[model samples]
Target: MKVNRFQVNVILGIANGIISALQTLWFIPYIKSFLGNEAYGYVSVINGLVNTLMIISVSVGVMSTRFIVVNLEQGNKKKASHYYSTEFFSLLIIGLLISILGIILSFNLRKVMNISSGYYNDVQILFLMTLFSFLIQLISAPFSASFYVKNSLFITYLIFICDYLSRIMMTIFLFSNGEKVIWSSALATDLVYLGMILIYYIYTRKNLPELILSKSLFKIKYLWDVMRSGLWVGISYAGNVMLSSLTTYFSNIFCGVIITGIYSAIMQLNIIENTVLSVLISSILPKMFKLYSNDDNQSLYNYVIDSMILTTLFIGLISSGIVVYGSDFMSLWMGKEFVKYRLLIVLTVIYLPFTLPSQVINQVFTVKNKVAIPAIATLLFGMLNVFLIIIFTKWLNLGIYGIAISAVIVQVLRDNIFYPLYLKNIINRVKWKLSIPFLIGVVYMALGISICFLVKKVIVPNTILSFSLSVIVSGILLFLLALTLYRKKEHLGG
Candidate 1:
């Protein structure tokens, strides 16, 4: 009855995929029907603003997974407890700082986002709700991280499903009857995180007693160490958020909130691509930590390569399918108004194939604790992306497509060109190991592009039917190709 890491990850991945797809299908179209694009745009703006505020908490969670697994693997129970205790207090303080900032921002948010006076109170309540939600997540970072250390992703996914289901149902009910969509959605989300905290607390008390904090919880050295280790990751996390947040903010300031809503919807569709890559990389991450801790470089190298190739191929298949049918698909999913942004979808997906592989490689950096390089790289490139988004959208008048163009250019430079060179210098025998995956990716992408071209030429009439066929067909073909190739070159998975 017990599940291995891969099995759990696949189950979680499929479960999340279904949930996310349903969410995208139900929430956006239903809300847009009544709430209108402008209201949805404001919602997106608030979400981005709050996400930018949560960067430090995200960094702490990432570091918690690393340190918790490291200390636990070493059989140092006290050290593991210290790691948990350190991040626990540190994030609580950060959450307090966020609360003060959130309060101030709530007053200025209407003017800053250029909202009308009618929705001011609604926006304020949503902002405050998001702030509370984020604060709870911050304090509960260690408990959540403990779940990942135990490979309890199924629990995470279960909570995520419940969260989305509740949020979607509430959104439908409220939006249908002319209630505030923003408030309902934000409240549902905050409630889910609170529920996650409660469940994790119960689980820890029952099964993970050693994770409880002790008298050493306030040790200055331990707190300093966790902060020091997580600093670059925090910067890196902030940098990553800056990339997308800057786009949304710049688009809102220059192009208007309507465009922001449309762009956000396009990005939500692309999240399906991200979910696949995330599932694969996250599935192998705990194992990577253990392998690196044992100094099993060969196994670790193999894992990184196989995961990158698999992710690259699968993302390529899905993204390429999107490139072929996204215009009709979005129009059918949302409304005919969304069809105009097909080029935006194309440009957004161009980065998926490349970004997914880079994420896998970034996991290598995290496990080796060589995070500074990628962290610095992400910050520098993020700034570059922001600069380019401003230039293209503001000056050149490229409109919404400008944001997508800027993101792809920066992603190619950072992930494809720079990261490989950085990894070669540090890890031994990585170049040869990376070569196979790299070559395979090149071949698979070429085939994917050709398949996309063929599929695009097909004269399908009904948008929904066409979209369904494209996904089902492409998925089957991609899986079979992977199975055939893996069988022929077994060493690829070694």
Candidate 2:
């Protein structure tokens, strides 16, 4: 059987995610060896700052993809080109403004984050370099959307892999040649983004010739049209950043750079897991947009439910493995010191089943252009998360664990309860019993964790080889168990 474009996209996306994740995992130890853990903490904060600032750019990119895909699907090439041009020019202006803001913020980073005097100057320079890279990325966001418009997501993933590889090689080369500074990593990133932007522009011009970059195509009306949707999207992105990335900043404020570095290290696993899962889900967005455009509500509903199940299943399986074997893996990878923070790893990932499936619902809101309430809800809950983190850390003295706990509580409230109920209102034609899928996800995760824990007790994998074998065995068993449970549920429904 020949695989279709969707299958190809999923496969390539997973490959890209895996490669990118491995590169990150490797860089953690490598960077720690050279920059030391304290510098690593500062680097994490700088990255978080840059990512937080990029919310507008990401929102514009998202809305551009949605509008371009919808119009292209409807055979309105001119409308699509208008959106493309508007997104490009709008980001160009926004990117410059944000770059200035980022520079000013870079000066004050020492005040907010507990950066030591020794690394402050180097960290400031690194922040500036990273900010410049973000400017390039912001401007190139529209060019990247062309891949989505053409349903060639694999090309995007391929470019991402290439970018990651080049960054790795450049960082290695720089460090080997007696340039083992944190700013060097930022320089590598800067060069890679510059190269990737050229690739994106060339691809868009060659393949999506209709989307020409002309001053005439840039319309204020189109920009307003995008912002009508993109504003809420940007709010949602801000909320998400507050929930996830700001944890590093908070960790620094409450616990100091050493503890912050440890927390950031553990959170990397969670980040990689979420990125991989999101990549898989994103492979379906063009299809989702097409389905919604066609007014195939039933098919759209089916697609949503199917994506939720698959996403939940993958999260369950992967999270269970992490909860069970994470300590051992970290011990082997990062040394024996990390074994003590196994609880942090568990706290980082346990809420995934409750939260991540809601990403599918988020995409639904985007396609339907009904994001106002959800965006507000997300922003409010995100603020609540910040408040709770402060209370838990400062008043209650829970330290970094308090940050993790705050995330869990807020995510369950927003993603599990609020998002589903709100989605019900938007897609009101069908009685969406959203709880069942969440319930099933909880059950699957609980079962997998229990079984894997038991298996771990029996097989104590000390060496890397034994750990690898155990992971393989347990993974297969869990997959089989999940398959059985899913089939049984299908049979009962049938």
Candidate 3:
């Protein structure tokens, strides 16, 4: 795999991801001071709904990327170019409709959530941002994929960095002047994102040869082909978004806004752990796509196995630390009062080891155009999330931990069920299982937790330092266990 535009894209991607993560980290103080916990909860719920719609817009782009990649692989630059333009125009139509629908749905979003108090205006403002954000996302997607085909990751990242920086500057500038600014900041961020996207659209138009809008570009045959390939991907993506983000709304409804705000901070920190791990794993897609494009099954197979092992190990150690010392991290990051919600933070921390595999496997099916299997998986996972959340939250009176627990439960189910099924669907030649290595991963988690308890016993004379030390010890043990269990053997390379 030649390092080209795609590698640049990956770098830019990591940069953008880092900036976004840092900006999110910085949001903690703003969240605590600008409004009540309910206000943070209010923003969370609106953000989730916006994400749900954003996922819907994303389905088209995700499919377009897959479709365009195949055309490029078959050496059909003409078809590939046409597909990009056609998809862009199609998204424009859908973008307009989505903006209208989102605007109309804004009132309903607030009504259904039944939010009251100083947040009503904030919620209204959030819905408007959703409308604009959705449009930007949909319109920019195809151009984003043009870079993907050529493997131009850096510029792809620059697009996001520019957008994110604008968002950050707005938030900082507003907050510095002592404004009530969460909603306003979000609005500014989305508008900046819109501007960055338009730049990409214009750039792609000028730079990419053979890109032109034509009546033939919109032919039914091409449209059918793209949709057929992407049919399952679109559905599952929608379900996954709902499942992943719906917890915010649930947290708000069941746990109170303040709790939601704290949970948001914890969740952000948890994602930071994953983001640090993401630095290692983020290169898989472009490289894997190139391997697959060249029909290099051997390298693809090796890359897949190695990726699973690396992701599992990296996330395992970090998750162990979070599950143990997250209270201290939260105390240090947010405040002491927020430490009461330690269980919520630990719940998110415990699950990432298992969760990262499902993410890897999703990319597998995506590149292969076998979207249906994963879509079904997401459906089952979403249903699982809802059912468990309902049973635990309402029937068992579980509170905030219910949402966290439900997430882990659904992730475990998705990893076990959908992964192998998608492998068979995509190639019909690969054999896979969940037997030994995965079980060892489970044991690794158990040991980390068990050791954490023992360390707690020894350090019990001093609670804070004890938990902190236990977390550190868990990290060391995980590193050794990972070395012993997850052997690096140049596994699965094309």
What is the model-wide C-alpha lDDT for candidate 1? 0.77
lDDT of 1 by residue, 24-69 (tens): 6777777676677767777777878888887777777777768877
Candidate 3 residues 173-234, lDDT tens each? 77778776557657776877767787777777776655665656776666667777666776
Model 2 accuracy (lDDT, Cα): 0.83
The CA lDDT of each predicted structure is 0.77, 0.83, 0.69
The residue pairs in collision within model 1 are none
**Compared with the true structure, what per-residue lDDT tens digits does model 2 show for residues 1-494?**
99988888889888888888788788888988877777677778888888889888877878887888788788898998899889888998898889789878988986677878778888889889989988988888888666666778898788778877876887789889998777776787788788889988999999878776887999989988889888998899889888888889999988888998888878877977797677867787878988988989878987887777777877788889999998888888777999989899999998897689888988899998887888889889889999999999999999999999999999999988898888888787435445656877888988899888777777778888878878887899889977876676564331
lDDT of 3 at 304: 73
List TM-score per model, in order: 0.94, 0.96, 0.85
**Which parts of model 2 have CA positions greater than 4 angstroms off?**
430-433, 486-489, 492-494
lDDT of 3 at 420: 59
Better of 1 and 3 by lDDT: 1
Candidate 3's C-alpha runs over 4 A off are: 1-12, 202-207, 273-282, 425-494
- Cα RMSD, each candidate: 2.2, 1.8, 4.0
